[model samples]
Structure formats: structure tokens, C-alpha cells
Target chain A: MPPFDLKDRAAIAGAGASAYGRRLMRSAIDLAADAIAAALDDAGLARERLDGMIVTFGSPIGADADTLAQVLNLKLRAYNQTWAHGRFTASAIQWAALMVAGGMADYVACLASVSFSGLRRPMMGGAGNSEGAREAGGSHGEDPVFGMTSPGAGAALVARRYFERFGATSAQLAAIPVAFRKHAALNSAAIMREPFSAGDHQASRFVCEPLHLLDYCLINDGAACVIVTSAERARDLRKPPVHIAGMQPLPAGREEFIWAYPGFGVAQQSVFDYDAGAPPVYKMAGVGPRDIDALFTYDAFSILAWMALERFGFCKPGEAAGFTQDGRIELGGALPMNVNGGLLSEAHIMGWNHQVEIVRQLRGECGPRQVAGAEVIQWANAYGDSLIYHR
Target chain B: MAANQDDYAKPRPAISALNRPYWDALRRRELVLQRCGECGMRWYPAAPLCPRCWSRRIEWTPASGRGRVNSWVVFHQSYFRGFDAEIPYNVAEVELEEGPRLLTNLIGVGAGEIRAGMEVEVVFDDAAADLTLAKFRPRRGAA
Candidate 1:
């Protein structure tokens, strides 16, 4: 199959998520069952029709593909799993799209379920996740030898670098979390519903210096599933098809930091002036950043929202600090983002929640938090993977 | 149970065949990085081949032991029990003269005082008899 043929050929048919909460005290498969069933039901897809699965955060924290199939009575024909990383959410959706388009699977459920409460110590760092003990170092640039542990620690480093490079202040970065919380106040399913002000953000203690506690995301238990099928099959389903207009796969290299943009220089990347120069997702979708009605990113940390904004040509390298201010990214703003409150205020289902929200918003299913007259929505990220979804 | 004063409770680098030499050099109080003999590209956290040239012709030589703090962060929360005593310790990503960045803790400066572009030099910490850590301290006579 030709590559460009994939543009708008595949799409999200349905989306659903389990309850988002701290210490839900449920097994991963139990939570996964709730998400998978809800997603299948949302599309009017029978449980027997769901034949493929791409499970992220699978293994120690979530349900594995094989285990989920066996326990859930699923007869999957194609299944794959990635390590417990939120960044894999985009990769899973992209693969599911290809699988559906290529006749490998008719229906693919891309989802993640995480139970962070069960672990005695949080897996953010020196815990069962083995993040710090990986070969060379952790994906987040964690070098435990120097006590540089946790993914947030890496993001804090990027935040500090960005502040120095752009002359931005921690006070300015507060706009991101503050804005997301406002969106959360409207989202009943969101975990952090209480609204907060910039003063509250400033009053919050620093988990890692330069990053307040609010800048970090909520580590809660939940499962979110988005079902993928060919655009032809999706149109036949219950809901309007959320077409996969464009896809930019995840990238990694010396220049690529998992949490920072290409030239922003977090890990092995060099320092330079970054020009986001028409990211391929926009081109594949035949649209520009300006055409995006609603934008959703993997907001594991508030700094990442800044990174994603600058990464996909939405703003200049250092301009996101200002571009995100004055309710710019909130609902009713010029460009609303994360109307479901995102991982920061919603829940971290390894970014599967963002996918669910994207599907809902594209379908105009998001009631109060919906972007009015929204036809195009995007799942862009700091790590350079993106999917442009249009209804 | 009494805590072993002699035991190193902190997380240590899992010395593998690939990065054993990097740790060995640190144990010797000498800072060394893989300098690709073919492409002359140097890097850290040790790789088997040159990342740039993909050449196996690599040599480990003494580094300048000097760099500037590229970025830094302070950990107010402890992830490792061994580090709980130093709850607010700072970790600085130093950009070396060879153009590779290393994540290390800076001595001779408090967490609040460290700034980006501050000149620093590598200092060895004999963390354990079998393990050594490469730390950095602010360089003298630097503006």
C-alpha cells in the first residue's frame, strides 16, 4: 500500500475511559475490561467483533496483551504491547490505524490501564519501573548515579534550560497548569475538578525546582481505550468517523529528547535556534497549525505543553511561554487545548485519555468543554509524534 | 536492623561490558569519554561505537574535566533512600568542552547558588570501594 494513501483512510470509531482516581485499588485487567467494554459499546461494536489490541503501559502496571485477551475472553488476531511509557500512546494509535487499513485487523483497540497505587513506591523513578536502571540511562535522561531520578526531574531540567534560553520565569509557566485546571472544573470525569489560580500554583511547593507541584501530572488509576478501524468501516459504525487525516510517527535520535523538542537541547541534543518549519503531520493532513480548531497534547508536565506548542510550528521556540498566556489555550480561546483537563488535571492513562478526549471533541461529544464549531482536533506532543483528527 | 555504614545504599550504575571502562576510569579519579578515533566524536554514558560515525574505532582518553552548567534542577523530594538525607540536593547537566553533557551533582555551591553557564570541574567521589561517582565543583577563577 502506498504511504500517502493512509491519509484519511483510517480513523477512530469510538472512545471510552474508566473512572480516574487516586488509589482506585483495582487490578489492571479489571480497569482495562471497563475501558474496552465501554469503547466497544460506544461504537456499537460487539465484544466479539473487537479482534485486535495495542496495549501501552502493559507489563508491571497494566494489562499485557496476552493476559488481557485470555482474561477478557478476547480472540485477538493481532496484538502488540509497549513498555509502561505514556509516549507510546501515539505509537499505538498509529500502528492500529495501519493495521486496520492494511486488512491486518478490522477493529483495533488502542488503550492503556495503569494502577500506580498498588506499588509501594511510585514508579516515577527508583521503583519497579526500572526507569533509572535502563541501559545507558532512562528514557527521561535519568542518571541515578547522580541522584537525577524520575521523569519530572528530567522535565525540570528542560524547564530550567527553557527559562534561561528564553528569559521566561516560573511564574509565567504557571499559566499552563492553571488553565488546564479551569478546563477540569467543567469536566465531571476529570480527577482534578477544583479550579486553581496562578497564586495557588505559586503557593504549591516545588517537586523539582523550577517546576511547582501543580506542573506535574496526577498519577491516578484509570484505563482509556480508543477503537480504530478503516474509515469505510468507521462510517458504518454508530458514531461519526474521526478520520486520521495525518500521522507523524514518534522520532528518536541524538537530536530527539523524549520530553523536549528537536533543537531545544535536553538530552544529547545540541543548543540552537529551532524553527518548527511545517511539521509533516500538518502537511499530511493538508492543513497548517492555524487550521487546527482544538489541540490536545500529552501534558505529563506543564512544561511539555510549552514544548509541544513550539515543536509543531504553533509558536517559535521560546514563544510558547507567552503564547499560552491570557486564556489562550483554555476553552473559548483562539486555540482551546485539553478540554478534558489532560493528564495534569484529568488522569494519566499513559495519554490514552487524551486520545479519548480527542475522539469525543472531534465528534462534538464534549458538551461544555467542547470547542464550538470544532471540526479538526490534533494530538501533538513534545516528543514529535502527532495525529491530526478531523470529523 | 541497623543500617550498614559501609554499604552504599544509593543506586549505582549497572556496569556492563559496554560501559565498564567509563566507570573504571571514574574509580581511578580520572574523567574519560569515548572519543571516536575515526570521526573524532566524543560522547558520554558510554556507547560501544561512535554515535556519529558508527565506527567501532573508539578510544578512551582523559577529558578536560571542565565544563559549564548547561542546565540544573533541585530535587526537593527523595526517590532513593540513600539520598533522603540530602533531600534538596541539586543535579546539574554540565556541557563538557568535548560537547557532551553529563548529569552530576555540583559541590562547593548550594542548590540555590548554581546557575547555568557556570564553569565547573569534575571531582571524584569514592562512593564505595567498588564504585566511584564523578561529581562537579565550581571552577576557581572563573567569572
Candidate 2:
């Protein structure tokens, strides 16, 4: 796939997110509705105007995309719930933008939510029926049977591989949570906003090997949505449309299984596979990594954020630890990744808060935690599974 | 005193139209997954259309079961009640010889025994009733 630039094709007119943290009283459906309404309110666009709806897959809730569209009374041309592995949050929005550009719909509402607070039981068992969906297992379905069900375990394998390949240590990986919590200290909305030190992260009890409790993402209930429309229509809206300067997703590629130890012989799934959509976003936006005013990448796990930076060409693969160690990713540095405190401190709303942060940065609205005089912003997500979505 | 043997057991996940092939293939101890005949895309949680090509021409193929060790972790914590006996076990990302990478457990090796780029062969652990879990053992000289 050849890379192309989306100079001024689609724009994000409005974005919204529900309050982060535990909300056991709220059902997942209510949370989705709340988030959808919040986004429409932000865009100053009526709910009736929404013609398209895109949702996420793997959400514990059984509400399908069509069901949500009907309940919201969203009379639209297309409605699809994308595979829900965090990274696609922004990718789903990009898909909505493409649909609108292609005339499939005029206005699209992209929604994602999670009910982590209510998940008292360990995440295991089959992924019951949904749209075109089979239970999430490998070729064998053995892991599910053996109770290896949490995203944490799957991610831990990646983290271990990362360290093994790069010769990094557990202490180095600890720097990711340390940096995020430091930034979270300035974010009032962040769940674990207290300042943390390297010592603090190392001292936290181990949740999985080479991964201490701090290395994991927070399990909280939350939802987020964004409204997208054609750039021309956005001009007449209530708010100054945040132009969708560029959108990029992984290129489609063939897979060859290498299920051995550190399977690097074949690229199972990496940024290399992403369909070359908009040029490296920074270039298409007429900015470079250093010029990025504010940055937001999915923080389902801090390692994801670190890997994204490396893949985006901000730092060399193994050099991310050193760059993070120097406080470059924190506020007042060259770039402030996740200004709204990412999923780690903020609500783990399927990485929707990351999107909220990008809009807030472009609008210059984040208060004490805000980066000063922010102009261009970047938002990216890496799904827990093989699917990679970048926009 | 032990009560009736099966009283407390959780019911098995029912096999339906969507997953019959996957369950049947597993019961036969052959790992099968769908691949796009047009785009050559492989998928788990099999679906009809290729996510990349949008082609409904997907074929189910058995995997080679030989892969390199892409990544791994030694888990010191247990979450699922069924995983209680698996404390300190190794979870691995095996890049199958067939060209797909998956999350599975590695057995027949100690924590220090596993390393990046090591060749591993799939071995079945049929602990659960009617289920054969895919586990891996280190290829000799892989260390």
C-alpha cells in the first residue's frame, strides 16, 4: 500500500468522555449512551444528525453495533463494531471518516466503552456470540481452556520478548509507569494520580513476572465518543473543527507462524504490516516528532506507549527507555505524551481518553496538566491483539 | 467428605455453528485456522470475510506446529481460579511454523531455560476433559 496524505479531507468536530474510575451502578449500555450524548453535545450537533456509528469488539457487553444504533435512534447508512482491542479506538474513528468521505454516511459517531469495575471474576471463558465473531482463541483454543485469559498475560509475553530482544531490564520497564504517574500527578482526573518514583514502581507487588503491579493498566469503567464529519460541513459547526490532518493504519500482510521462543523470524504483526495510509502522521501534519505539541498513545499498558513511540520513529526501539528516563515524554519536555493522563491514570475507556486529550490539546483547553501553546497533536493506538490501528 | 464429583463444576462452553469447526479440529489434535485464499491473510476467531481483502474465500488449514520462540514471560501471579496450580509458569508468544503467532504456555523447560529465537515444538497437555492444550518444549541445543 502506497502512503498518501489526508491534507484536509475529514475533521473531528467534537469529542467526549465519561468520568473515569469505578462506576459500578452504571450499566455498560448506559455508559455508551452517556458517552455518545456527551460527544454530540461537544460537537453541538444534534443526535438526529448522526448517520453512521462505529463501535469496538471484545467489549463484555453484548450490545451490538446495530442495537446501539437503534437504541440511540441513529438513522444511518452504516454501523459496524470494530474489533475492540484498545488500539482501534482512533482507527475506528478513521474508518468512520473514510465512510463519510466515501459517501456511505454524512456524519458518524464512533463510540467505545468498558465496564472493568464490574468484572469481579477473572477474565476467562469463551467470548460469547456477537457479530461475525468466534470466541477469541488461537488455532487450538488451548490457552482459554488452561485459564490463560487476561490481556495482562498476553501482554506480559510481549514485554518479556521486548526486554529479551533489547537486553532491557525490569527496572528499565518500570520507568514507563514512573513517567506516566509523574505526569498523572498533575492530572486531577487521573485515577492513580499520586506521584510515583522508580523505587515505588519496583516496590509494587508483582502481578506477572518482569511486570510489577504498576506495569499494568488500571481496570476502571468508562466510555468515550467522537463525532466526525466532512471538513466542509465541520466549518459550519459550533466548535472550530479539529482538522483530521492525517490517518494511518497498518498495511495488510501475510502471516507465517513462528511460535517458538522470541518469534522474530517472521513479523506476526507489527507497524510494518500497517497499510500505508497517510504519510507518517507527523510529516503529513507538517510537523515532526519534536514539533508534536502534545502526544496521546494508548496506555492499556505503558509498554504499548513505549513501543508506539519507537515505532512512530520518535526514538530508536531500545532507546525509548533512555528517552523516557530523561523525562522527554513528560510535560515541559519536547513532547508530553498523553496529556490527559492515559488509560493508566485516567479511565481505561478503551483508550478513548487518549482521543479526548488530543482534542483538548488542539483546543488548548487542558488546564494545569496542559502543554502550553499546543498547535498540532498526535493520537495513536496499538491493539492488544494483532490488529494495529493508527490515525 | 467429598460430595458428588460433578456438582461444583462449571458448565462447558457450548459448541455452536460459529465455532464447531474450531472445536472439532482441536478435538482431533490438529490446529486449524482460516486463511484468506486471495490475500493470504490468516485469522483466529475465524470469520467468513477476510478483514483485509473483504473476500469470503477463506480456507481452513492445519498449521505446521513448529515455530520459533518470539517472546515469553514467567508469570509469578495467578488470576483465574483454574490457574492456581500454574503459579510461576511460563507464558509464551510462539510464532508458529505456519506463519501465525499465538499466546500459549511453554512446558518441559524451566524459567531460565527459555530464550529469544529458540526453536520449539508443540506438545499437547490434555489436562482438561476432552481438551488438548498446546504447550511447547525447548528444541535440543535451543539454549
DockQ for each candidate? Answer: 0.79, 0.33
Cα distance off (Å), candidate 1, residue A140: 0.5
Reported per model, the fraction of native interface contacts reproduced equals 0.78, 0.49
Please give the TM-score that candidate 1 achieves against the real structure.
Answer: 0.98
lDDT of 1 by residue, A1-391 (tens): 3544789989888899898899899988899999998999899999899999999888678889899999989999999998778898889989998888777899999999988886676788764448888888988988888888888988999999999999998899999999899999999999999998899999999998989999999988989999999999988899998899999999988898988987787778977888889888888889999899999999999999999999998898899999999999999999998888989998888889988988888788789888898998889999999999999
TM-score of chain B of 1: 0.93
Candidate 1 docking classification: medium
Report the Cα lDDT for residue B93, model 2: 73
Superposed model 1: Cα runs more than 4 Å off: A1-4, B1-6
Runs in model 2 deviating more than 4 A are: A1-5, A57-59, A62-64, A118-142, A145-147, A252-283, A383-391, B1-70, B93-109, B117-143
Cα miss at B90, model 2 (Å)? 1.7
Q: Largest DockQ belongs to which candidate?
A: 1
